[model samples]
Target: MTLNPNLRLRRAARIIVLDPEGRALMFRYDVPGRPPFWVTAGGECEPGESFDAAARRELLEETGIIADPGEEIARLTPEFITVEGEPVQADERFYLVRVSEARIDTSRHTALEQRLMTQHRWFTRAELADWPEAVFPESIVTMIEQQERAR
Candidate 1:
C-alpha cells in the first residue's frame, strides 16, 4: 500500500539506543490504531522540546531507559498501510544514542494501551536482522549496517 502523494504527513523522530554489545533497545506495541511493530523509542517533538529532548523523553517513557543523545544517524519517511489498509504517512528522523542504564517500570508508560510490551529487552544486531517479517522497521536494519561498517 502506498501513501497518497497529496497527503500531508507530519514529522517525528526516533532514537536507536545502543548498548556496548551493539544491542538496540526498542519498543513493541500492539495497539488497535497503530501497527503491531517494534520501533525505536521516540515520538513527535513536543512544543519547546528539541528533537533530542523528545527522543530522550520517549525513551524514558516507553522503556524506562535513559541515554545521552548521540548523533543523527539516518532519516526516512517511509509510508505504511494501516491495519485497515489505509495509507498512513510519517516523516521519521533516526538518531543514535548510547545508553547508560535501562530498567522496566510499567508505571512510566501510561499513554500506551498496548499489552504486548510492558518490558524491554536487548537485541543484537544480528538478532534484529533475523526478526520475523514486518516485526521491525527497516531503518533499524540500516542503522545496524552503518554501525557494522563503522566498527
Candidate 2:
C-alpha cells in the first residue's frame, strides 16, 4: 500500500521487555470491530528526545515498568495506518530490556492507550511462535530467535 506523504515520518522507540524467566512482555490492543493485535510497549519520541530516552519513557508510560533499556538491537521503518485513521511512517528502534516482574501498572497510560490497549501478557518464545493474534513487526519470532542465537 502506498503511504500518504502528507503524514510525516515518526521516530519511535520500542522495548522488547523480557522478564526474569525470559518471557517477552507485550500489550494487547483490541479495537472494537477490528481484529486484535499485540505490540511491544513503546511509542513515538517527543521533540528533541533521544531514541534511548524515548524507549525508556515509553516503556514506563505504557507498562509502568521502570527499567534500564539496553542498547538498540534492531531497527525498522514501517508504514501503516494509525487507529485514528492517520497514515504513519514509523522509524522504530527496538531495545532489549529486562524486568524482574511481568505485572504492569496501567495508571500511566495515555487516553488512547487506556481506550485501545486491553491487556498485557508475558509470552515465552515458544508461545510467541504459536501466537494467533497479529504481531506488529511480523518478524518478532525471527528476531527473538536471532537474539537467542547471538547469545
Candidate 3:
C-alpha cells in the first residue's frame, strides 16, 4: 500500500518485556468493531528524543514499568496503516527487557491507547508460536530464540 503523503516517516521504539520465566509481555489491541492483535509496548519517538529514551518512556507509559531499557536487539522497518487511517512507514527498533511479572497498570496509557488497548498478556515462546491471533513482529519466535541463545 502507498504511504500517506501527508504523514512523515515514523521512527518507533518497542520493548520486548519478558518475565523471569521468559514469557514476553504483549499489549492486546481491540479497536472498536475490529479484530484484535497483539503488539509490543512502545511508540513513536518524539522530537528531540533518542530511541532508547523514547523506548523507556513508552514502556512506562504503556505498562508503568521503570526498568532500564537495556540495548537494542533488532530493527525492522514496516509499512502499515495506523489506527487513525494514516499509512505509516515505521522504522522500529526493538529492545529486550526482563521484568519480574506480567501485571501492568494501564492508567498511564495515552488517550489513543486507552481507547484501543483491551488487555495485556505474557506469552511463552511456545504459546506465541502457536497463537491463533495475529502478533506484530511476525518473527517474534526467532527474536526470542536469538535473545535466549545470547543469555
Candidate 4:
C-alpha cells in the first residue's frame, strides 16, 4: 500500500456508550464555519497510553461516568482534521460501553471539547442513521449493529 508520509498518524479510542434503554450517547460538535456534527465520546490516546485506558479516561472526561469500556468491538481508520486543524489519520478502536442509566455531565471536558462541543443527547440507531447532522465514522449505524448483535 502506498503510504502518505505527510499524514499524521495517531492512536485513539472511542466508545459507543449505550444507556439502559438502548440509546447511544452522542455529542454535537459546533466548530466555527462548519456544520454541526455528532460523535461518540472519545479522544486521542495520551503519549504511551493504551487504547483501553484511553477509552476509560476519555469516557470519564467526556461523560463524567467511570465505567469499564465494555468490549473492543470495532476498529476503523479514518482521516480527518483535528481540532487544531492538522490533518490526521486516526487509528481508532471502538468499544461498547453499556450503562445502567442515561447520564451525562460535561463539566470535566477538556478545553477543546468544551469549546467545540455544544450539546449532548441520547439517540437510537434510527436517529443516528437519519439525524440532520452528520455523524462521524459515517458507518456508525452498521458498525454499532454488528457489534451489538454479536453481544
Top candidate when judged by TM-score against the true structure: 4
lDDT tens per residue, model 4, 19-122:
98788899999988788889999999999999999999999999999999966887888778886778888889998888988978889987888799989999
Prediction 3 TM-score vs. true: 0.91
Q: Which 10-residue span in candidate 2 carries the lowest summed lDDT?
A: 1-10
- Which stretches in model 4 have alpha-carbon errors above 4 Å? 1-3
For model 4, state the Cα shift of residue 87 in Å: 0.6
Q: Provide the lDDT at 53 for model 3.
A: 98
Worst 10 residues of 1 by lDDT: 110-119
Q: Across residues 53-102, which tens digit of lDDT does each residue of candidate 2 receive? A: 99999988988888788888899888877777767888889988877776
The pairs that clash in candidate 4 are: none
Model 2 lDDT at residue 84:
72
User: In candidate 3, what residue range of length 10 has the lowest lDDT sum?
Assistant: 1-10
RMSD of each: 3.8, 2.3, 2.5, 1.5
After TM-score superposition, what is the CA distance of residue 24 in candidate 4 from its true location, in Å?
0.8
Report clashes for each candidate as comma-separated counts.
Answer: 0, 0, 0, 0
lDDT of each: 0.66, 0.84, 0.87, 0.87
Cα lDDT tens digits for candidate 1, 1-151 = 3555775564567878777777887766665765456777777677676667777787677666666566667767777653344565766667777665544444576544345464456778777888773445665867777867886
Q: What's the C-alpha lDDT at position 83 in model 1?
A: 34
lDDT of 3 by residue, 1-151 (tens): 3444566689899999998899999988887666788998899999989999999999999988998899999998788777777788888899998888777888998888888887888999998988998899898889989989998
lDDT-superior candidate, 2 or 4? 4
Clashing pairs in 1: none
Q: Report lDDT (Cα) of residue 105, candidate 3.
A: 82
**Candidate 2 local Cα displacement, residue 116, angstroms:** 0.5
